[model samples]
Target: MRSCWRSAVATRSSSISRPRPIGDARWRRAELGAQPDLTAYRLFHGDAEGAPGLAIDRYAEVVVVHADSAAVLERWLPEIREDLRDFASAYVKVHPRRASRLTGQDMQQAAPAAPLWGLGVHDVEAIEGGVRYLVRPDAGLSVGLFLDMRDVRAWLRGNARGLSVLNLFAYTCSFGVSASLGGARRVLNLDLSRAYLEWGKHNYRLNRLTLDERDFVYGDAFDWLGRFARRGERFDLVIVDPPSFSSSPFSVTRDYPRLAEAAARVVAPTGILLAATNHAGTSDERFEAWLQNGLTRAGRHGQLAQRWHEPSADFPLAPGRTHPYLKVRALVLD
Candidate 1:
């Protein structure tokens, strides 16, 4: 009887010990095709990959594991650390489903201050397409940069030459930095958070780009857009990438059309406007309709120059899903 019980326990342990097949094939492909200077990317997209409630990202020497709950994070963290043994450090960040109910102390308790594996090195640099941006693995919710927008930044770098660019909702100004590197004549980064604007300046200095205080605007995007329109200021390239939901009066479902109309007003004739949303609930058809309505209201006619979705290789859609969460369209306004 004792021997049988021991065998049963062993069998269950063995079954649960194996690591989920995450980052194996993807890492191999990345290693083979990766540029020498690029170092940051999504190692595992949990919802689409084998791991349903967890995702992993690499930033230089550190690896961040994001989970939907503390229990899920703790359960799989050991296996993930073993699987990514080559990484210098690993940190786990739990995003509770009902975050609105939790207090600051509850969140702090959920995500411990210490690293799960190796030394606690929170701050690091993430290089993508040869442009460097600062990242903090231990930062709550989001580190300085959003890995999913890597392709969009790359596109801006390649196409922004000689254009005057305006980047709205510029968290840390990653898009502005990309535009600067791409040789844009001028780049204006607008955001509600002054601290983020300062961080953007640090990014500019990191790339050895010149600093002009006027270029970093600190105000609400809607107000600034109105002011720009009144002042007859226009941009050759306008980027509108607002958060899906924010404390401000912005809701992707309800306000996207209004936002689009405001953005279209400041686009120079024949200029390019890149509008994007990462709201999984909003369908592509609905999003496009909102853009069309906004354009029509603003009296601007345009053609969709390019439509970009999330990079499929790294961010594949989950099972039974037809489209990825991110949707971006570049319109050439006339």
Candidate 2:
């Protein structure tokens, strides 16, 4: 009996349980009738073309849809838009289903016939806080907000009280808002796109945060960080969230190392650093190794707090479904 119990315990411990609705169908039915809060409704499963990459986001009454798969592009279009209206207001924003040059032709071929479907292209939404702005995916290369970073934003809000916080690659400055709301006296948001920065400003205004609350700088992250170091400008809290690849001036391969060096300079003694890389090829071990090297070169050793793993709701790892590409890892520095 003792051996059997030990085996059972080990089995349970080894498995990762996913979040699911309770067994009571009535309770689930009740929830289905009501619109869920933002955090609660993180994913929308698509069935058109029977592909897995398509997803829809319901922002209050606004529906933002993305189709990243050729299969989905071919099958679901106007139908998907109508289905989303059940949750959204009246407007539905649709982005092109282009993935790579390889899929560009396919996407165009599978495109919907006319504008009668209420599908139209528009500029992405920008949100601002303190010194940062976030260009959300609603109108840009991808989804505007990285929802997985919700915890990191929460962490900033809790610890950034009265301190100056710096947000690097501040896509939409969601963290800046959280930190501002948390009581941070000043915040700085840095990004490369003027369009995204403008959108971010809108988000800040929507939240009723003031310009004095944050600063938005549009330029290369490395140049800004280096200049910040030279000017003796330091931040009490720094959040680094970078994309894996860039087609424009900033490439992670050519830039992350320099950014790390600049971060070391601007980081205060008691200040905290949050560094993240979302490259699917990058493993937790790789992130740790790179950070260790960066810290060593900076002649400063910081503690690695926790590793945050983000699993996509669109593609959950189930019986046969595979989610081998997406990776999100964060290292907290002290």
Candidate 3:
């Protein structure tokens, strides 16, 4: 796909005016229809797919749009909704304005959000790669599921069976859910938020999977990593997906090499580790270097088993780019 970053200017007879690409409408529709299990997808990737300033997503019957530029997004929201109003409802989320310049109080006020049309519902069920997950349409800040991690979830399901898995920074335990769905013998989800972990339990329930309180842990990932390292607790597959910045007692490492070192300590001698960062600024090469440095610090001569990236059709990328905002790298510790 070509770069969709055109500066606020109008598309010259391009699909931008239509929001969801008319050219790919049939293909998009067919893709969504064919995959009943994987319902959530990028109906239109704003700025990158075609519609600048707007990112249209589907959660089963509901459609969610997140736009960075309300000024530009406002004009197309209606037409976009009308052209494809066959389904349920529609919603739009405005990007928080120039956060860099906003004061702390001002920062607290988030971007505006409202339902454009259709029935606005919260309780919605959806699937991805045949895996069931919940979606809360009212979560203007988030749509419950991070669709970009679709490939990562699939990878966990395939590689985690029969292995003890540890998912750190597990938001809503999506990775853990996928691991259990894939048959992981022992899966542990650790996160700072208890509410999300509880939500994760709900997800487990949806899949008819058993849940142990011991398995769903609540704490700082870094702190627990230290405890697990000292206790000689090891996992065959360790997943470390951290947010950009963490607050309170748990401060995430800006030092990538240090993070890698901490992550390796919890991995079994013959284990596989998958670490990812969603920070768009971090290139794949830079992230890999951090991973390599972590291995060096840990004194573990690990092989770069596999490198991962966004693979679903919805999260398309431009050519000649190292990483598409979200970067993931996997390794085998020897």
Predicted candidate 2 versus true structure: per-residue lDDT over 1-334, tens digit per residue: 1232233234334333632111111122233224222322233444322335555443333345556554554465654543332332222233442232325444344333222234342433322122233333223334456644655565666777898888888876677778887899888988887766766677677667887523988887778878988898888878777777654555555566566767877877767677877665665666666666666666666765554555333333434433333333334445
Q: Which stretches of candidate 3 lie over 4 Å from their true place?
A: 1-29, 97-114, 245-253, 319-322
Alpha-carbon shift of residue 174 in model 1 (angstroms)? 0.6
- Number of residue pairs clashing in candidate 1, backbone atoms closer than 3 angstroms, sequence gap of 3 or more or interchain: 0
Better of 1 and 3 by TM-score: 1
Residue 169 in candidate 1 has what lDDT? 96
* lDDT comparison, 1 vs 2, better candidate: 1
Give per-residue CA lDDT, model 1, range 168-251, as digits (tens). 999999999999999999999999999889988988988899999999999988999999899999999999999886767677
Per-model clash counts, in order, read: 0, 25, 0
Query: Which pairs of residues have clashing backbones in candidate 1?
Result: none
lDDT of each: 0.82, 0.54, 0.73
Global lDDT for candidate 3?
A: 0.73
Ranking by TM-score: 1, 3, 2
